[model samples]
Target chain A: MSFVDMLLRAEARHRSRLCVGLDPDPARLPGRWRGRVEHLYDFCAAIVDATADLVCAYKPQIAYFAAHGAEAQLERLMAHIRVVAPEVPIILDAKRGDIGSTAEQYAKEAFERYGADAVTLSPFMGFDSVEPYLRYPGKGVFLLCRTSNPGGDDLQAQRLADVPGQPRLYEHIAALAQGPWNRHGQMGLVVGATYPQEIERVRAIAPTVPLLIPGVGAQGGDAATTVRAGWRGDAAGHTTGPVIVNSSRAILYASTGDDFATAARAEAERTRAALWV
Target chain B: MSFVDMLLRAEARHRSRLCVGLDPDPARLPGRWRGRVEHLYDFCAAIVDATADLVCAYKPQIAYFAAHGAEAQLERLMAHIRVVAPEVPIILDAKRGDIGSTAEQYAKEAFERYGADAVTLSPFMGFDSVEPYLRYPGKGVFLLCRTSNPGGDDLQAQRLADVPGQPRLYEHIAALAQGPWNRHGQMGLVVGATYPQEIERVRAIAPTVPLLIPGVGAQGGDAATTVRAGWRGDAAGHTTGPVIVNSSRAILYASTGDDFATAARAEAERTRAALWV
Candidate 1:
């Protein structure tokens, strides 16, 4: 199936816009599994089992595993999902960007190594930096546009006073990605929920491109506002595609106790309720 | 010894501005070692043996190893260097940028896992992104300011219209790195040698900070111009203190024949001689 179609179906089946982010910071992991991969796997597996029905996708940050020198474990973790939650989309949260050959290597790593359904890319290197990933059918690429952090405004929001019309850099990136890089239509924009205004503006620019909305839970973004601002209000009036709301810390670290899975499920249910309403 | 002092001493003793880049692209490896770690080890060891005296530092791009699922080989490659050329500074070429917590993990990888004297950083997330690496004493942090690629100018050279008096984005980054982020004075900038004019401008902005000049040889940068633009000019306008010129593919892949080491050594010696004169 096409990446978009797959996402839409997943969203409908789950009746949820929630995306569980598996950002396993070892320091924050509960109980005796602090540095152990088995403990990490158990924790992640339990969470997946509990919240699988509530989320449309699960995003595993590659750095977390690479940090542990447990690349093999990461492969195992992804393979386990292939067996367990085979229906849910897996978006590997690796913000990689490079030119030509190097970008190809990263594309292979995210797609071939871990077998992620979609991958987050750093569009800082321009459109070609994203082209290699598009070659793979049924895979999606999320380009960083308006980020969630405070300092995101530093370079992203910087305007070209020297240029004629004074265009914001992020808008230029959005236009370029939408125009040329979206040839395969598998491209998406990572518009952080923290900036609703930027989200609305970017949505207007790249109306068809999907928006991977991160920073909802731990980053303190309001779910309703994000959906409303991000939702496409075209001639269809009630827009209904290309936006996946993501929540990481709130669901992943719901409980430090042995009943962590139960707590995670509760968190997922709460987030699902908050979104569906 | 402190990273800055060690860099200075290494530069003086080597009597060459060369910095060899160890980017062992798996696809580009010889057919004999087509699909194996031992082949990578042999290739890297040969390069180190041939070029240790000709260069001040060895830079290994982490992406090449990470792409091949040769994470174990990365540690082995660095250890190989420690055994062969212990005095040659190892600058792990990882353009890592993340939040405070994640940045610490990257530092541990570059410092503890690979045992690099310095690591190149991508300053996309602002000061907080690089602070974790700088906190470690006797370690060098070379932040990406202006890259050599065509599209690099898209964002790095952006100017804010609202803030008319503000410096170009890269200039602001250079200043910030030199200011608060330069805790140990071990901070440096990776200003590509391709941009000689920008190199001169950045040198003025970051006069005291060390510069890691890449883009020589295969990248089409003139060695003489790079040395003049980066180093200090005395009364007779002679170049001075701590600048390492890097050349990767041009030397390492100088030959695909059995005399590959001899070819690599010849290329390194040629590059070294061209820069000094």
Candidate 2:
């Protein structure tokens, strides 16, 4: 099945738009796993099992695993997710961007090595950098647009003078993802949940593509505002536009004790409830 | 020692500006190593040993290693470089960009886990994304400004209206890298050699920051034009501004025989000579 089809199906089956980010920071691991990089798979597996039915997707940030040389564990985690939450798609939040050949390697790493259903990318290198990822038949790629950080304004909010009436860098990315660059209908835009206004604008430009909205829980974005701005569906509950709102720390470390997995599930349940529109 | 000082020292010691890129693509490996992922380290280590005294720096594109799930081999390769070429700095060509916290993980992956002397990054996420890496005192960071890819024109060439004189996006990055972002004097800009005119423009805007220029051999960038545009030095051969011209495939796959490493050394010597003023 296509990535979008899997996402929509998972969303409908679970009645959730929440995507739990599996960022296994060793320093924050609980109990015996605290500061133990070896348990990256163990810690993340428990959380996945607990929230198996509460999320439409699971996002594994590659940097977190790579920081501790835990990619083997990440591979194991990907397999574990496939077994425990088979319908839930995994998006590798790698944010990779490169020229054609290098981009192909990253695309392969995301799809073949880790079996990610989708991947996140930095759109800085432009269309050719994004082109290789689109070659994969059923995979989806999300381009970073209008990020939540204050410093994001330094570049993302700059106006492009030569483009007709002038659009901000992020809007240009949104338009590209919505139009020409998204040839296969497999492209998505990542507009942070912290920027609801920008999310609305991105939704206006690219109404139907999946928007991977981060910054909701620990990053302090309103869950309702994000769904209201990006989610579009029919009265019969058919989602034409999808919003995958991601919350990492708030759910992962709801309690930093031995009941971490249970606490994570409770938070995921609460987050899912909050995001249900 | 600071990464810049280390680079300058290496450049003077070697009398070369060539930055050999240790990108080991399995299918392209020579002789018995053909299509073998296990020999990633061996292939790269051989090249590094052959060219250690002929180049100022070594860049290992992370995607090439990660694609094969050979990151552990890359770790061993990094260690091998330190043992074989202690003075030559290593640049981990990651192009990583994210929000603050996530950026921390990537920074850790590059600096702590991989022990890279420097790391390449995508400046799309703005200052906060670039800020975390700056915290590592002696290390250096290179931000992608004007890339070699044709798709780079899509974003980097766009005229930013809000900035005075409608400077292009890459020019804006050049100004930032040369100005406030160089707080610790540890920042550099990556301006591709394929666009020599753009390289000159970046040089004129930034003036003193190191320019990591890729796309020389296989990508068809002119070595002489690249040097003329970015390299600056005094009569005594003391470089105030440095240009690290990188070549990967041309040297790595110079021959497909058992004498691959010797051919690689010959190519590296020729490349270093071509870049020499």
Candidate 3:
């Protein structure tokens, strides 16, 4: 099945559009799971176990695991997720971009080595940098469009003279995504929920492409505004678009105390409930 | 010492401006060393030992190691480089980019876990995405600008209306690198050697900043044009600018026979000599 089809099916099965980010920051882990890289795995496993039935997908940011030299642990976590929550997809938030041949290796890293269903990519090098990842038929690739960070305005918001009416670079990227660059039907855009206006603009530009909306929780994005702007409905007024809202630190470190797993599930439940509006 | 200072010192000591990329592809490995990830380490170790003295730096593309689930072997190769040739620097060619907090973890991954002297970064998300990597005082970060791929023209060549004369996006990035983004004197740009004209423009925009010029060998980048357009000279005609030309497959798999290491050394010597004039 295509990534979008699988995503829609998972969303329907879980009755949620939430993607819990498994960014296992060692410092923010609970007291019981505080020390080694092994603790990192335990923390992620506990979060996955607690929130598996509530979320549509799990997003693992590769840097957190890579910082601790824990590729094997990450692999184990992916395996654990596969066994425990087989229906939920895994999106490796690696944000990897490179030339053609090196990109093929990264495609192998995300898909073959780590066994992720999708991966994030940076489109700075343009088409070829992202083309290799599209070769995998069922996997998805999310291109960073308008990020939630404060410095995102530095470049992504710049006006392009070559574009008609001098549209902003991010909008230009959205148009490209709607046009030739997305031939495989597996391409998506990452427009942060922090900027609802940009989300609306991106949604208008690329109406049907999936948008991995981060910044909904710890990054201070309003759930109402994000859902109102990004959540497209069918003609029957049902929320049918692929807007996977992600909550990373808010859900991962809901309570640093002993009841962290329960707190994470509660937080995930709350976020999922809010998205229903 | 800063990255530029160390790089220039290495260039003066070795009298070479070549950077050999350690992208270990299993299919290209010699017949005897084609089995496990340990063989990957041995293959890279042999290449580094053979050509470390002939080049200014070694760039190990992270995807190749990550593809084979061999981060430990990559770490071992880096440690070996530190012990074998202490003067040469290692640029972990991980084109990583993300928001600020995630960028910090990637910074740790490159500087702390991998022990690389420098790293490659994608500047698509702008200032903050590249900020965390700048925290390490002595390390280097090369921002992508006009990559050597055919798809580079897709986005980097777009004209920005905000700039004075609507210069191309890559030139705008060059200007930014020469200006505010490079406060610590450790920043550089990756302008492909394949496009010598773009190299000339980038060289003019950021005269003193280092340029990591890839695509010199198997990518079909002309050595003569690369040196002529990239190499800067002082009033006395002494070569002064930092233009580290890179060749990966051509040097690494110079001969797939029994004398692969010897052939690699010869190829590195040839490329290094070509960068002089």
Each prediction's DockQ against the real complex: 0.52, 0.89, 0.88
lDDT per residue, candidate 3, B15-129, as tens digits?
A: 9889999999988898777655668899999999998789888999989999988899999999999988788888999989887778999999999999888999988888988
Q: Which stretches of candidate 3 lie over 4 Å from their true place?
A: A234-240, B236-240
Summarize candidate 2's per-residue lDDT along A96-153 as a digit string, tens digits: 9898789999999999999999999999998999999999998999999989998889
* lDDT for residue A128 in candidate 3, whole number 0-100: 91
List runs of model 1 lying over 4 Å from the truth.
Answer: A162-165, A234-241, B35-38, B163-167, B236-241
Each model's C-alpha lDDT? 0.80, 0.92, 0.88
Q: Each candidate's chain A: what TM-score? A: 0.94, 0.97, 0.97
Give the per-residue Cα lDDT of candidate 3 at A16. Answer: 89
Interface RMSD of each: 2.1, 0.6, 0.8
Considering summed lDDT, which 10 consecutive residues are worst modelled in model 1 chain B? Answer: B29-38
Candidate 1, residues B1-277, lDDT tens digits: the string is 7777766666778887799998887656654765564577678878999888788889988777777688887888889888887777889887776665557877887887778899988766667767788778889998888878887776777776765466787887777677767886878988888888888888877888888888999899999998888877679865444678899999988987777789999999999988885
**Cα lDDT, model 3, residue A14:** 84
